[model samples]
Target: MKALITGVAGFIGYHLAQRLLVEGVEVYGIDNLNDYYQVTLKKDRLAQLQDKPGFTFQFLDLCDRQGITELFQSHRFEYVVNLAAQAGVRYSIENPHAYVDSNIVGFVNLLEACRHSSIQHLVYASSSSVYGVNPKIPFAVGDNVDHPISLYAASKKANELMAYTYSHLFHLPTTGLRFFTVYGPWGRPDMAYFKFTQAIEAGTPIDVYNFGDMKRDFTYIDDIIEGIVRLLPLAPQLEDVNSLEQSTPQAPYKLYNIGNNNPVALVRFIEVIEAELGKKAQKNFLPMQPGDVPITYADVDDLMRDVGFQPTTSIEEGVARFVQWYRSYYG
Candidate 1:
């Protein structure tokens, strides 16, 4: 069994590759190694896999059409997971072009590649940000996500639509995982969890956006990986879609929400961080930023029904684990 993981150096992508390699599956990975964040951290992730068996990596970008085409043609990948994107709501407000290039155009390139190949399933990462300003609680796959306040969210929503098109037209079996707030060791530094830890340790003030009233369905990295692994071999089947049953077409496409069913308030999340660090955080309360949602709760009923699993990690445990890694890595 061979799999291809784009953004192989990313936090999620790296962890997934490690899991698959341990399963004795041949893994081919790729990443642009863009310096959107710390390139050193990305390289450290790759270093952990570079010496492992059944693993091969290439420096490639999804936006590179010819490169992706060549890669698909060269090797037969049973599964493909794309986790690369210009990831950040606030960053999108600053740099919208990056989102379009990587998330939109890059994704189209990948979809085109998968359509022409004999891939079993193409699982891509979507975001909870898609449920922009939605009044709905515990956002479900069936809920309407027609409106988006950020380019990052719109790009992810576009990915779901594009994948469905390929599944409908070309019979490309695809799955889109709408992830909630994912955090853990080796996570992105730009994330609130990581930033809060950084500032608290540095004795600086952490900005509390939305007056620290926002709630998020914080999911652990391991939990997210488990959901993906369970779904990889369980691609959507056309037969599963009855003519009068589902509202959509008879396509081999599935979408699932990978999240802890519980939503954690920002203040509570901070308390966990503070408890783990054993340090008090100086906070600066602030109003909601543009393109920011006050809450993100995921409806994981469908995910549980399909995969028999949902995220079970608590913020306390997850935060402690992250702090342990942060201390060890930084030391």
Candidate 2:
């Protein structure tokens, strides 16, 4: 099978590409290589896949309508995975327009391309941030997500709506995966786990937001990739749509939360990092930041039932793996 993966240089994207390549799948990957985090790290991720067989890379932006259309016309992709987006909640608050251009306008261009290309299935990355102020203990796919606190969350929710519209109007098969806190080796430097590791290694104080009261469903990268691989062949069928409680009978669209059902406390997460690094962290507890949620607990019952798998990586093991990669890469 052939697949098109946007944001191929990203942490999750790179890992997904690697797994597909191992399974003898031809993968066409694209990335703008934006300096949102560190361009060097993205380049390094791409470097790993550059020499792999059945893998190709292109420097392209999702916002480029003409370029994207040309790409779709040139390659007949069976599956399209849209993981490229202007990520980060706090960054979205500072620059709302970035989210609009990438998450909204860019997404529209992708939908148009997919619709015209008649792609078999389109899987896109949705975030747990979309839950936004949801008081529910474990956020479910059927839960109401009308209130979004951050522009980032709003853009993701908008993507889900847009995908549903495409599925209903154009009969495009779409599936949205709401990812909880994903953490692992070669992960984003902007993530808390990475930052905390860097600070503790340097003997500096790590910033503990929400005064260490926050909790997150930190899912490992391997688990997330496994879930995606299993769902690729199980696209939403129009005939079986009614069986899905979260989907409409008329639309071939579905949404599922892929997360470790267990939520880890912020302090406990830091302790794992410290233990892995063999160093003590000087934590600077601070008030909750704007656009930050106190906790993110995902209810993955539907995902488990459909995929027969859910993220099961524990925080301790995941943190240790990340710390090993960080030390080896940075040393």
Candidate 3:
């Protein structure tokens, strides 16, 4: 099978593409390679897959309508995974337009392309940030996400709505994965784990927002990739019953929370990091910033039922793996 993966140079995209290629799938990947983080790291990820026989790379922006439309026409991809978006909750406060342009506009472009091309399945990245300030523990897919604290979160919620529209009208099979705080080797530098590691190594003060009161379901990258792969083949199915019944549409639409389902406190996460690096961190405690949630936990019941998604890596094990990679890559 052939697949098109957007944001191929991204942390998750790189891992997902690698897995698909190993499974003998033809993978075409595109990324604008925006300077959201280190360009070198993104390039390094691409380098690893450059020699792989079934991998193809395209330097394209999702906002380019003509380019994306032409890409679908040329590639004839059976599946398309949309992962490219302007990421970062805090960054959204300073530049809301970036979120609108990439997350909303770019996503619509991809959806339109899918509708025109008759793709088999469309899976895209959503975020746990959509839960906003809700006090609800173990945020479920059925929960109301109408209140988004950040423009980034709002954009993701919009993506899901848009996907639902296409699924209902065009019968496009769409799946949205509301990923929690994904962390591991080759993770995004803007994430807390990555930033903390960098500061600890440089002997600089790490900014601990919410005064270290935040909590997150820190999921490992490998486990996330595993869940993605498992769900790829199992598209949603639709069944009608005289009485009310749960429906799984075969026309291709579903949403799942791919997470560890365990929320770890910010301070505890830092302690694990310090242990892994063998150094205490200098923290600058600060009040919670705008567009930031105090806690995020996932209810992966749908994911477990559908794809049997189970995360096995503990925080200590995951952070140690990241620290080891950080030293080897940067030192």
Clashes of each: 0, 0, 8
Question: Which lDDT values do the candidates have, in the order given?
Answer: 0.93, 0.92, 0.88
Query: lDDT per residue, candidate 2, 127-236, as tens digits?
Result: 99999979988998888888999999999999999998898888899999999989999999999999999999999999999889999999999999999999888888
- Sort by TM-score, top down from the best: 1, 2, 3
Cα RMSD to native, each candidate? 1.5, 1.5, 2.5
TM-score of 1: 0.98
Q: Can you write out model 1's per-residue Cα lDDT over 214-266, one digit (the tens) per residue?
A: 99999999999999999999988864432123666788888888999999999
- Per-residue C-alpha lDDT of model 3 across residues 242-264, encoded as one tens digit per residue: 11125633334677888898999
Between prediction 2 and prediction 3, which has the larger TM-score?
Answer: 2
Which residue pairs in model 1 clash with each other?
Answer: none
Per-residue error at 80 for model 3, in Å? 0.8
Question: Higher lDDT: candidate 2 or 3?
Answer: 2
